[model samples]
Every structure is written in C-alpha cells, then in structure tokens.
Target: MMRVGIDIGGTKTQAVALADSGEIAASVTLPTMRGEDAVLATTTSSVVALAATAGRELGEFSSIGIGIPGHVDRVGGRVRNAVNLGVRSLELGPALRERFGIPVEIDNDVTAAAAGAAHLMSLSGTVAFLNLGTGLAAGIVVDGVAWRGQAGAAGEIGHLPVDPHGLECPCGQRGCLETIASGAGLRRAWPAGGAHPGRGLVRAMESGDADARRAFEGLVSGAAGCVRILALSIDPQTIVIGGGLSRLGEPLRQALGATLREWSGTSPFIADLKLPERVQFLPENTPAAAVGAALVSRT
Candidate 1:
C-alpha cells in the first residue's frame, strides 16, 4: 500500500505519497500555519491534497507519518517546544489518526531526514545526518533503522557547549555549537545581512564585508567541529550534510573539506579518520524529511 508522509516546518509543510517500491508517486506543499489548531489543520489538508493528487481515498494509504521539529514524544505522537512553528505542545499523532482512521507516527525531523538520506542515497552501515539549518542537530541511522537513543535525545549535538564565553543559546547554554554555525547564529553575528543571512553571505563577502567573512568563517569552523564530533563519537560510515546553510552548496562543501584538512594537518589522529572524504551533501531538492516520515510509518 502507498504510505503518506508529512514534513512540517516553520515556513512550509510538504507531504508525499510513496508507492510500494519507495518512490514518491504524489506530493503536495502548502504554507504552514502556526499554533496547535492551525498546524493540525495544515497537516490534515496536506494529506487530503496528497490523496487527491494520487486519485485515491485517504484510507487507501497504509500509514501516515509525520516529521516535525522540537522535542518529539515518538511513542505518544506529541510535539513540544517547537518554537519556530509557534507550537508549544501538540497531540499531532492522535489528531491525525482520528481524522483519517489510519495509523500515524511522529518522528524528529532530523531523524526522519536521516532515514530518507540513507534510503535515497542507498547508504548502508551507520550514517550520520548533520542538519545545519536555523539550528544544528544530527540524526543517526544504523542500517535502515533510526537510533533515537534512550531518551530520544541522541542527536542534540547543537546544544553541546563549545565555548563557555560564547553567546547564550535558547537552551540556556552559553557558546553552544549551534550559536556559531546555524542560520540563527549567522543572523546574530552578521545582522547587516538582514533576515536571511546565508542568502547574502557570499555576496557580502565578495564585496569585502569583513563581518560577513568572519561569520562565514565561524560557520565553517563550527560545522567542521560538528563533523569531527560525529566522526569521533559515532564513527559512522558516512556523514550527510543537510539544512538551510547546506544550500551554500559547493562553497560550503569545499570549505568544510579545507577546514577538516587543516585540522588533520594539526593532529595525526584526525588525519587518520579521513573526515573530509566521509562528508557529503544531501541531494538538492530532495524532501528528505517528508520521504523519511513516509518510511518511518512502516516501522
């Protein structure tokens, strides 16, 4: 049976209907509204749209899965503290299941992305997905299964304090890795770049904006640090980069490689890990979280 997956984000929500063979047979995208009721309405509409796109009834799909940000109670299908989406707490799973009369599953967005990346990229063994979006986090997939850790905090590397003297994070930590590498971090550092700092970063740097250059350098270093931490801790076979900052694309990849190489030059152990070779970007335009949510439904 085809599976339906929904990815809810701060700006937009995307849903996809996946065929039995794992290909997306139908999809829909819509602006995501804020608050519990609106969010639920948006999700419901997306699923309805997907069903219409595929010319099938809602009950025809085998399952419906969701990938959402913030703290997720996977078993309970609830979301909490999803600040960007204006969601404080929501019973996402039960609401959807009741609406469609199909099984519903909820997963962390990054975790869902990990599953999608592994399947879409045809990766095996342990794979780490590092999300460098408005914030930084990671998701781990072993074989085809997600490793959410004992308390479902497995990939919260963004909150790890890297600098005690650095800026305070929303998580009540100072100098967290996310404060240096994420889109929020860039906005905090380079306020002149306006709302979306990453979009104008390269141009500002090209025009010799010292602040932009510094922000970019910090982003690269922080991202490299995340990679190093993932390599040393998880020892994954591959590290897939995703999120908003990754849109910097080739320049970001090359800079990350250069940073890793520089670290390797300083430490023999780092060189032995061959981190630069293990890093890769998520394929452009792939709705990893949405596809992953679909995959998660069966599990």
Candidate 2:
C-alpha cells in the first residue's frame, strides 16, 4: 500500500508518496501559502500531482497525513496557532478530506518528526526530539507513542527560560530558550541581532569563522543546559537534534558534549545511567513528521 504525507513548514510545503515499506516513490515541494484555504489547497494539488507522477491514483492511497506547525486540535483537526505560520482556526483535515475524498490526519509537525525519527533509529526505549528550525520545539516518544501532554503543550522547549529578563517570546515569556538558542536566536546575537553573511551561518562555523564560532559557543551553554534539565525529568536514552542549527556539525557537537559533563549532576539516578546519545541530525530528506503522519495512518 502507498500513503501520501505532507510536511507544512512556514516557507515551504513538502509532499511525498511512500510505499508501505517506507520507500519514497515520489516527492514534490511548493511555496506554503498560509491562512485561508490557500495552504491546504496547495497541499491537495501537490499531493495529487505527486501521486500521478508515481503512477498511482490519489484515491488508491490509503491516507494523507499533514504535520502542522501550530496547535492542532486533533479532535477537530483545526490548527489554532503557530506564530510563524500566521494562520489559525483553519480546518485542515476535513477540508482536505472533503476535497479529495481520502482520509486526512493532521498532527503537530514536531511530534510527527519525533515518531518517524524514533522508528527509523530502531529506538526501543525512549526518544526525545529537539527541533531547532525556524522555531524551537521538542517531542518525546515513550515506548512507541508520542507523549502529548495535557492541552498539547508537551515538548515545547522554546519557551523555557534561557533568559528570565531577555527577549520576549511569542508565547508571552521573557528570555525563551528559542530567543537565545534557535536560528533566530543566533541571528539576534550576531553583530546586529540579524543574520550572518553568506547563505548559512552554520556552514560558516565549519569554515572556522570567528563570529560564527562565537554564535555556536553562545548556544552550547543554553542548549546543554536544556539537555541536563531534560535528563533530570525525561532521562531519554536518545536525544535527536534536528533543524538548521544541527548542521553546524562538530563545533556544535563538541561544545554540547563538553558542557554535558559539567552540567550533568552526580546524583546516582542522574549519573549512573549510560551516556546519553550525542546529538544526531536527521538526514536532509529525513523521516519527517509528514512521513510519520502517514505512517500513523497505516497503524
């Protein structure tokens, strides 16, 4: 059987047709149009187009799963808010189902990504996901299921207090972890609270540029602190880091590794466990949430 999956990001929407075996038979991307029906419209059109390219009919697929960036009301299939999306109160699942006559499942994107990544890793125990793209969020898989807390606020690490009196987060918190540790966070600490020159700052860190190095260093303390805090609570066997910043490679890796030693306390419960998994960035064409969303449909 084949399923269609869509990952709707702030800037782009990606669709993939996957065999039940998890092979990508076809894929396509389109600029995301937020608000109104435009975003869902683009997704429906793209999925149909991709299915046709794969030599399959859209009706033949079992399901379409969407990983939304905002607060998804699972029961209602409505996206309530995602500040970056600038679109809210949209009925995605029903809208897509109504248009295409196929079952649609909408989920929080990070949660989907976490589920897919955990499965790909063959992670049997617990897996915690830290998503660091244009935004900061996390998702945890206990056993084989994502632990979505009450009101769906679990794994939202961006609003954690990296700075109590620092930048104001959209979540109405002061000094959110995202304000200092996300891509935008790095940009803010750059000379002008903006982006570094050239195409990608993480790549600059690879080139041994001084400013880029500083930006990463700035992230380590906060980022590592997060790991420690997570250790205290979740104690996940693996911590998977995704999104743009993980592309920084070893500079980012080494910094966090070193800080973990300092930040991880010596209490037996905290100290005696196996060394946590180092941060591993998922592949460019990764087991993303959309894939997980579709995978969920199969289950």
Candidate 3:
C-alpha cells in the first residue's frame, strides 16, 4: 500500500508518496502559508496536484502521516505548542484522519528524521541522529525503535542546561545548548550581524574570518560537550548528522571530530575508545523528516 507523508516546516511543507523499497512515486511542495487553515488548504491542493501528475487519485494512499514542528503527543495525535506554525494543542492526527479516511500520525519532525536515519543505517544496534538547523534536536534509536523517554521529550538536548548563568533562552532556561549552538545562536554570535549562513558558520571559521572563527569555536565547545554527554549516556554505535549544516562535508566532520578528540581525553566514560566510524554523508540529502513521516506505516 502507498503511504502519503507530509512534513510541515517553518518555511515550506513537503509531501511524498512512498512505495516499497523507498521508491518515491509522487511528491509535492508548497510554500508555508501564514495560518493553520491556509496550511491545510495548501497541502491538500499540492496533494491533488501530485495525484494528477501521477495519473492517480489521493484515495489510493493507504495511510497519511504528518511530521509536525513541535513536541508531538504521538498517542494523542496532537501537535503541542508549535511556535513556528503558530499552532498550539492542534489535533492534527484526528483532523486529518477524519478528513482523509485513513490512519494518520502526528509526530515531531526530529523523531521522524531519526527514524529515517535509523533505517538508512540499518547496521545500528544503537544510533543517534542529530539535526542542526534553525534549531537543534536529536533522536535516539535502539534495537530499531525510537526511545522517546517518559515525557515524550527525548533528544531535547538543546534545553539540557549547558550553562547555568550564561544566557536566557526563549525556552525559559539559562544557557540552553541551543542558545549557544543553533542557527539563531550563530547569527547572534556575529558582531556585524549582516547576513551569513547561520548553519555554515563553522565553514566560515576555516575561511579565516576572525569573528566567524570565534563564534564557531564556541559552537565546537558546546558541541563537544553535547557529544561527550551523549556518548556517556547513549553510547550510540552510529551518529548521523542531517539538516543545513551537515552539507559542509568533511570540514565540518573534521572540526567536530577534533573537538570530540579533545573532549574524550582523560574521561573514564569514554575510556580511549575511538568513536564509531559510522558518520554518514548523504550527498543529495532528502528532507528525511518528510520522508520519515511518510514511512510511519512501515515503522
């Protein structure tokens, strides 16, 4: 059976029809509109258009899944307090399931991405998937299933209290890791503050830009802290990086690896073992969260 997956982001929404073995039969993209109704309408229109393009009908799809932008109550099928979508406590699964006449799922986008990463790296006993974009988050997979923790707040490393007295985060915390390492954080780190790739600032560091280098150094410091913490706790066999910054290729990997090397020293938690050689580089990366949303049925 075909599955329709939709991913709603801050600037765009994407939907894909997935068949066996990850073949994409149909796909759609729509500019994210300003309101909830507009977002749904735009998505439906795109689905219809894609159906026409494929010479089929949307009714052929067996299930629909939506990867939403906030903490998701997966069991309740609700999107809880999405700041980007201007939505709070929206019952996306019920609404869409009722409308589409099929099972519908609403899950956090990062969770979806993590699932995709896990499937892509099938050798995993345990795995970590990290997305560094406009925001930062991660997903954990163990024995091929996501571990979402009791509060459905797993992989929320951003709010993990990296600095007790550093800076106040919009998430109402002092010096959360996201406040120091995300795209917004990198942008804020710039003194000139003109326009730069918030995600690519690490590469900008290599270019010998003094301010950019300093900013990225700070990012490495925070990132090292994150890696160390996760390494001690999760002990993942593979760690995959997705999102805007992962496109930097080897430079980003090497720099981050260097930091990891430093952080690994003299720590009984790490014990001089090398990090797994499982960092994947998907050249033409999919918006995995969108594709993973589509894969909910398979999961």
Candidate 4:
C-alpha cells in the first residue's frame, strides 16, 4: 500500500505519495495558509490532491504522516511551541487520523528529514543529519530507527550553549548554536542588516570584503563546533548536512574541512576520529522531510 506524507513549513506545505515500492508517485507544493484551522484543512486537502495526482484513491493509502515544525508529543499526538505555524497547541495527529480514517504519525520536521536522509543515502549503523536551515538541529538514526530521546528533544542541538557571551536566542538562552551556525543565525550576525543578509554576506566575502570574510569565518567556526559536538557524542558512521544554507555547497564544506583540520592538528583524538571525512552533503532536490514522513508511517 502506498503512504501519504506531508511536510508543513512556515511558508509552504509539501505532500508526497510514496508507492509501495518506495518511489515517489506524486508530489505537490502549496503556500501554507495562516491560522490553525486553515493549516489543518490545507494539510488534508493537499494529501488527497497528491493521491489523486498519483491516480490513486484515498483508500489505497495505508497510512498518513506529517512533519511539523514544533515540539511534538508523539505519545499524545499533539504539538506545541510551533511559533512559525502560529500554533501554540495542536492535536494534529488525531485530527488527521479522523479525517482520513487511517493511522497517522506526526514528528519534528528535522527528525523526519533525518530518516529521509538515511533512506536516501542507504546508510546503516548510526547516522546524524545536521540540519542548517533557519534553525539548527541534528537528527540521529540508529540501525534505521529514529532515536527521539527520552522526551522527543533528542536532536535539539541548536539550543546547545556554545558561547557564554553570544547573542540571545528566541529560546530564552544566550550563545545557542542556532544563533551562530544556522542560516538565520548567519543573517542576524551580518554586520549590515538587509532583506537577505546571509546571501549578501557570502557575496561580499567572495568579492574580497574583509568584514564579510570575518563574519563567515565565525559562521564556519560555529558549524564546525556543531560537527565536533556530534562527532564526539554520537560518533555516527556519517554526518549528512542539509537545509537552506546547503546551497552554499563546496564553500561550506571547505570551511568545515579547514576547521576540522585545525582541530585535528591540535588534538590527537580529533585526528584519530577523522570526523571531517565523514561529513557529506544531501542532494539538492531531496524532499527529506516528506519522504521521511512516508517512511516513518510504517514504524
């Protein structure tokens, strides 16, 4: 049986139908609507539309899954603190299950993406997916299963305190990794404020702007810190980096490699682990979260 997966983000919602053979049979993207009710309505409609687009009926789907941007109570099928979605508390899973009369699963978007990465990469053993999107987070998968931790906060690496005197984070903390390493962090750290500060900073740095170079250096250092933390803690088989900043591509990986080299030279343990070589990039068009949601429906 095919499965329906939905990835709900702040700006847009994506739906995909995964055939029994693990192929994407159909997919659709739509602007995310505002308000709790509208968002729920849109999600249901989008999944049905994807199924139809795949030339299949809703009854053909065995399960439905959704990746939401918030703290999810997997046991209770509820979500909270999803500020971008303008939802404080939502019983999304039960609502969708009732609407479609099928089993439904809900999880953090990044966690779902990690599952997708593991599937896409065909990785085994332990793997960590470092998401450098608007926020920073890491998703851990062990032997093909997502490890959500004791409280579903397992992969919240962004909130890890990295600096004692760094900028304050929306999570009511200072020096969180997100403030230094994420795309949003890079934009906020830019010396010149603008509509697209991160891109502007990168451009300026490429054009030989000293200040932009310094800013990027700091951002690169933060990213390295994230990798080091993941490496020392989980020692996963590989680290898959994805998200919006992934567009930076080689430049980003080069920065990460340089930092890892510096640390490896200073510490024998770092050199022995060879963490830099384990880092890899996700494909440009991979719908990690949506595909992951479909994969998780069975679990």
Candidate 5:
C-alpha cells in the first residue's frame, strides 16, 4: 500500500507519497498558511494534491503520517505550543484522519526527521538526529525505531537551559540552548539593520571581524554542547545534524569538530568516544523527516 507523509515546517509544508517499496511516487511543497484553520487546510490539501499528482486516488494510500513542530500528544491527536507555526493548540491527527479517511500518525517534526534520516541511511543501533533550525531539538532512534520518551518530549535539547542569564525563549525559559544554537538564536546575534542577517554574519566572520567571530564561536560552542549531551546520555552510533542550520554544511561540522577536539584534549573520556567523528550531515535535498513520516504510517 502507498503511504503519504507531510512535514509542516515553520515556513513551508511538504507532502510526499511513497510506494510500498519506499520509492517516492510524488511530492509537493507549499508555503505554510497562517492561522490554525488555514494551516490545517493547507496540510490536508497538499496531501491530496500530492496523491493526485502521483495519479492515485486518496483511497489507494493505506495511511498518512505528519510531522509538525512543538509538543504533541499522540494518543489524544492534539498539538500544543507550536509557536513557529502560530498554532497554540490544535487537534490535527483526528481532524486529518477524518478528512482523509485513513489511519494517521502525528509526531514532532524533529522526531520524524530523525526517523527518516535513519531509514534513508539504513542505520541501526542508536542514532540521534540533532535539528538546528528555527528551533532546536534532537530526535532519538533506537534499533531503527523512533523514541519519543514518556511524555513525547524526549529530544527537547533546545530547552536544555545552557545559561541561567541568557536570552528568554518563547517557551518562557531563560537561556535555553535554542537561544544560542538555533537559526533564530544566530539571527539574534546579528546587528539590527544587517541585511540578510545569516549570510551577512557569515561574511563578517570570514572578513576577520572580531565580534562576528565571537558570535560564530558561540554557535559552534552551543552545537558542540548539544553533541556532548547526546553522546554522554545516549551514546548513539551516529549523531546526524539536520534542519536549516545544517545548510552551514562543512563549516558547521568543522567548527563543531574543533570544539570537540578542545574538550577531548582535556578529558580522556571525550577523547575515547571521539564524538566528532560520529557526527554526520544530511544532503541538502534529503527530506528525512517527510520521508520518515511516510515510513511511520507503514510501521
């Protein structure tokens, strides 16, 4: 049976249809609509359109899976505190299941992405997907299965308060890791009037600007801290980095590696683990979460 997966991101929503063999039959991306109802409507329509594009009726697909931001209550089929999508609280799984007339599975976007990455890489054992996007989070997969913790909030490393006196996060916490490690956090470090804040900051850093370098270093440190926590806590075979900041590509990895080396030089345990070597980056076009969403329905 065919499976459909939808990723509801902060700015864009993507839908993909996968055949029984795990090949993508069709996919579509649309700007995420504003407001609660519109967002739900857009997601539903996107899935339907993707199925039509594959020349298959909705009934042909056996199940649907969706990945959305913020806290999710899987059993209740409700989403809470999805600030980026502007959805405070919404009942998504039940609504979509009713509309599509199929079984639906909804999960945190980062978790879904982690599952997708594991599936695509054919990874086994423990693997952690650290998503550094508009927000920060990690998704853990054990033995090829996603682990959401008891409260379905397992990988919320973004809220792992790093600094007691740091910037306030939307989650009503001060100095959460997200404030220092995420794309949103990076932008906050830029000048108020800087054009193309992210690129501009990178350019400034490349030009030997002291302040820029400091900002960049902070990002590297935040990222390294995340890796350390994951390594010491889960010791995953691989820690895959994804999301918007992952676009920083090799540079991000290099900086992270440097920090890990610094720590490893001081601590024999860190040196033994070689956490830097375990880190990997996804290809720019691999929609692991969306793909994982499809995989979820089948599982």
Candidate 6:
C-alpha cells in the first residue's frame, strides 16, 4: 500500500504518494486557502488529486501524514497559532482520519523537512535542518528519528532574542533572529523590494542597491548565528540549509561559509568545529516536507 504525505504551506499545498519501496509514485500541488475550513478543504483536494494522479482509490493508501506550520499537538493531532494559514486552531488529524478512514499524523513543517532532508540526502548520525523561509526555524534528527523536544519548541530558534534594540518581532521579542535572517526580515529591511523581498535581492544587489546588500548581509549574518547556536547546542554532524530562501543556492552557501570561516578566525574552538565545511544546502524543488511527513507516519 502507498503512504500519502501532504505539506501545507502558507502559499501552496503539495501531496505525494509514496510506494512501498519508499519512492514517490505520484505528486500534486495546489494553492493553499486560508482559514480552518479552507485549509482542510485544500488538504482534501490535494489528496484527491494525488490519488487520481496515482491512478488509485483513496482506500489503497495505508496512511496519511501532514506537515503544517503551527503549534502542532502531535499527540492529539491538533494545530493552533498557524497565523500564515489563518488557522487559529484546528482538529486536522481527526477530521482527515475520519474522512479517509485511515490513520493521520501531523507535525511541524520544519520538523518534517528535517526528516525528509535526512532521508533524501542519505544522512546519518545527527542532522540539523535550518529553514530560512518567511521565518527562521530548525529541526534536528538523530539517526532516523526526530528530536521534537518537550513542548515541541526545541528548534524555535527564530524567537531567540539577539539584539535588545533591534526591530520587534511579532512574537513580541526585540531583535529576534527571525527579524534579521528571515524573508519577513528582508521585507522590513528592504521594503522597496516588495512582499517577497528575497526573490529580487541578488538582482538588486548586483545592480548596486545598497539597501538590498545590507539586507542580504544581515540575512547571512543572522543565518551564521543560527548555525553557531546549533553547533554549540546540538553539535550536529551535519547542518542542512532548507526552506524557500535556500533557493538562493550557491551564493547563499558561499556567503554562509565565508561568515562561518571569519568567525572561526576569531576562536580556536569554532575553528576546530569545521563549521564552514559542515554546511550544506537542500536540493532545489525537493518536496522534503511531504516526503518527511510520509516517513514520520511510519514511525
């Protein structure tokens, strides 16, 4: 039987059917609708589309797993505080299970991405996934299992206050890492870049836009801080950069590595950690969260 995995993002929803051999057999993407009802409907539609693409009935799927942004109650299969999706609270797992007559699992999107990255990259030991999307967050995996931590807030590094007088975060914190490294941060720093600031950042910088350069540098510096924090705290074997902003690709990787190397020049301990060599970027266009949700469902 195939396992179905869905990744519900702020802008899009993607679903995939994984064959028994663990390869994706079918996949579908749809625009995600906001609100509890609309989000649920979007998820259902994704599954339906995936089933049709796979040429199988829904019953043929053994289980369904979902990766969504929010405060997920993994045990209870509930989600709340998903501001991007406009979901104040939702009983997503129960609703989906009832509709499909199968087991459903819910997890944080970043966590699912970590799992998917680990699986897809064939990584072992400790792996950390740093998500640089609209927001900054991280997820850790040891061996094949994810470490969600107590209260499921383990990798919420975005809220960690870094500057006492920096811009205020929606989380009510000043100078949060998210305020420096995330897409939201970029928008604030380069308001002229419009809603999706990261998209045109390189072009703007190449055209000698000082504001864009400053914003991009800030993102790199903030991201380097996150890597330092991860290295000091979890000391993971590999730190994988994933998320929308990761599409910045080689330039992002080179900038991050250079920053880490510069920091290493200041401290022997950091130099010994080989932080620059440990960094990696997720392959573009990989549906890591969806694949990860399917992998998580198996557990």
lDDT of 6 by residue, 141-179 (tens): 899688999878888898999889889999887999999
Give the count of colliding residue pairs in each prediction: 0, 1, 0, 0, 1, 0
Predicted candidate 4 versus true structure: per-residue lDDT over 1-299, tens digit per residue:
78888889888899988888888889998889877887888898898788779888889988988888878877677888788888888888899889889999998888888888898788888888898888899988887788888877876888988889988998999999888887677767675736545667667888887766776786788778888888888888988998877777778889889899999999998899898889888988788889888888778
lDDT of 6: 0.92
Tell me how far the alpha carbon of residue 21 in candidate 3 is from the true structure, in angstroms, after superposition: 3.1
Candidate 1: residue 90 Cα off by (Å): 1.6
Give the TM-scores of the predictions, in the order they appear: 0.97, 0.86, 0.87, 0.94, 0.93, 0.97
| Ranked candidates, highest TM-score first | 1, 6, 4, 5, 3, 2
Over 72-181, each residue of candidate 1 has an lDDT whose tens digit, in order, gives 88888999999989999999999988888889999999999999999899999999999999989999999979999988888789998888899999888899999999
- lDDT tens string, model 3, 165-261? 8778788888888876666667777655344455456555667788888767666566656665666677677767776656656766777787676
Q: Where is model 2 more than 4 Å wrong at Cα?
A: 162-165, 191-199, 202-214, 262-278
lDDT of 2 at 16: 80
Query: Clashing residue pairs in candidate 5, if any?
Result: 113-289
Clashing pairs in 4: none
* Model 2 residue 214 CA deviation in Å: 4.1
lDDT per model, in order? Answer: 0.92, 0.73, 0.71, 0.84, 0.84, 0.92
Q: List the residue pairs that clash in candidate 2.
A: 113-289
How far out, in Å, is residue 92 in model 4?
Answer: 1.6
- List the candidate 5 regions with Cα displacement exceeding 4 Å: 164-174, 193-196
